[model samples]
Target: METVRPVETWLTDMDGVLVHEEDAIPGASDFIEALKASGKKFLVLTNNSIFTPRDLRARLLGSGIDVPEESIWTSALATADFLADQRPGGTAYVVGEAGMTTALHEIGYVMTERDPDYVVLGETRTYSFEAITKAIRLIEAGSRFIATNPDPSGPSPQGTLPATGSVAALISTATGRQPYYIGKPNPLMMRSALNRLEAHSETTVMIGDRMDTDIISGLEAGIRTVLVTTGSTRPDMIDTFPYRPTRVVDSVADLVELARAGSGEM
Candidate 1:
């Protein structure tokens, strides 16, 4: 096997890479410990904007993972950071949970429903038709559309549920406007994460389960990418994509050795 270069920084997806539903995938805890012991900067990235990092940390702990709150990044934070950079102290009409709202507030953004500067959409368990209607009208009235992520659906115990991208599409169809998605697949999110880590893309590695979102974004951001087949993707599906991840593994367990190697424990 060819020697893999040690990465100084790591960006990993949360859903499939770390946990599946409420259960921690095998080796997840060890991988996190390895990264921490290596003294490398790492962030757990997620497209779900329904919960805050604190909430996510609690959830991960319940599943046997011990990641710190500061080490988790979400689409909500990325969206807020993007907005703050584009228009500081701007007002927005937000349709999301406390995670999205809190992030915007911390960045000095005001939340309003009447004639706001922008209509920010994100993940919500109970998406209100009335609110989506309001978003359409707001966009028609000249508010720019911005969505936290472009994921059409999200995984659940029962099944899949409509997510931010589906809601964004409804509003777009109603108002003839497309939302600027700020999560994975958009290199802006990766750049924002890199900035947060104070890390260079050349020496960073992105580990994710989905190729379309995680792998493609890392490639575009000039970082090494690893695709784990323990989540939404299957090994049989790898050949379908035109682009490929730098490495493919059966699960996160397979990376534990590499992670230890990166930490010079081999």
Candidate 2:
């Protein structure tokens, strides 16, 4: 048996792990502060591509969690990074919000609805039918399909709303082509985050709530994964999955002790 490496950096999910709707999870702030104090490179990750990092930072700050803008990595950023690396200055027909558009623009990607090289799908509060139609047409015309994340639904104040994955499926059904999902469960997102933090997978730990997206992605990326029960997944449901996280806990609150212990403070 191989001994696990001590955690030197941390990657965590945002929605269920840190905040729920606009509220901070209990002790989330302290866990983030402790990571900063311990001098460990860390990032708060989200599959939602509707908001930019600055926007997310403001939202988290409002909830009493002071995560830096640079410390927040969105699927929008990951998609853009992937595009830039795969085809620099590529043209795409974008079907998302400011977060997705701004990231593509920063990477010098031209957004066009006509004869684009790619059709990028992302999260939006209001996904337009016309836009979906256009995306379907583009994909039929040989535009490569890409999506920010594979989340079928996202949380809302009223209830769950159909997200990028649902819309992507609609488009795929129309065009008979599936999208290359760039977010969690792809492992590409994890590698991109690790690259952004200059962290190694062997010495980094991934903390998230969802087993399908978070744990699977981390495990495939060759990092230790911890599933916190404070979010989408319940402790009872964990055993249903054949793969397992390195550890499980009630919430991010318990991670404070683990982080401290890793730093030799406990």
Candidate 3:
């Protein structure tokens, strides 16, 4: 196969790529350092919306991956950005966690449960009937539905917890309205990351473990993609799937080596 051009920016998945269930992946810290050393810009674009961006950054740092606070972007942030463009100053009835409220509020979206213009969903450990009922009521009042991502469950050391998608499903089932997701596998996230780097698809490479979300987003965004085997995307499943990544490595360490070798640093 012909060699692809060197990567200028990396749009990476957060949960499984950098840390899984709050534990930093092996060599994740060094991977960040290598990218910084190569003058490459990277951001953790994750579907998780349980924590604010600042909080997530602190969590990652505590786990040994030292990434800049602003270098992190969550589905909550992307959802807010998308809403800002579509419904500036609109009242949003949020059905998620602190992350969703923080982001929507920061973007000037008013929080309201009465006659809201939008229903925003994010990750939440507690998915009570009252929250879903309120969202359904707003939908019945003609509120547009929006969601962070389609991750049905979150991975953790303990077990998988129902994610935002599950809540979105409840609202959808109750009101017959499907939400617009602003996370992985959606171009909204890819666009947000690109805007941050001010770069084009030709020079950007997406690195992730999931084919459905990460690689699909990258291909849709018209960028090269590399899949690593350290997370949800199992090794035996890669060849069986119709989707393909530009390259597949064993870990983040190999990702760094691949980038450096392409740039003549290896």
Best by the TM-score measure: 2
Candidate 2, pairs of clashing residues: none
TM-score of each: 0.96, 0.97, 0.94
Candidate 1, residue 240: Cα displacement in angstroms equals: 0.8
Query: Candidate 3 clash total?
Result: 0
Which is better, 1 or 2, measured by TM-score? 2
Put the candidates in TM-score order, highest first: 2, 1, 3
Candidate 1 lDDT, 1-266, residue by residue in tens: 96655578889999999999999999999999888877789999999999999999999999999999999999999999999999999999988999999999999999998789899999999888888888888899999999999999988999988889888888888888999999999988899999999999978989999989999999999999999999988999999999999889888887776676664311
lDDT of 3 at 177: 91
Instruction: List candidate 2 segments past 4 Å from native.
Output: 261-266
TM-score of 3: 0.94
Tens digits of per-residue lDDT, candidate 2, 1-266, equal 97656789899999999999999999899999998888888999999999999999999999999999999999999999999999998999999999999999999999998799999999998888898888998899999999999999888889989998899889989899999999998999999999998899989899999999999999999988889999999999999999999889999998887775655321
The deviation in Å at residue 176 for candidate 2 is 0.3
Per-residue lDDT of 134 in model 3: 81
List runs of model 3 lying over 4 Å from the truth: 1-3, 258-266
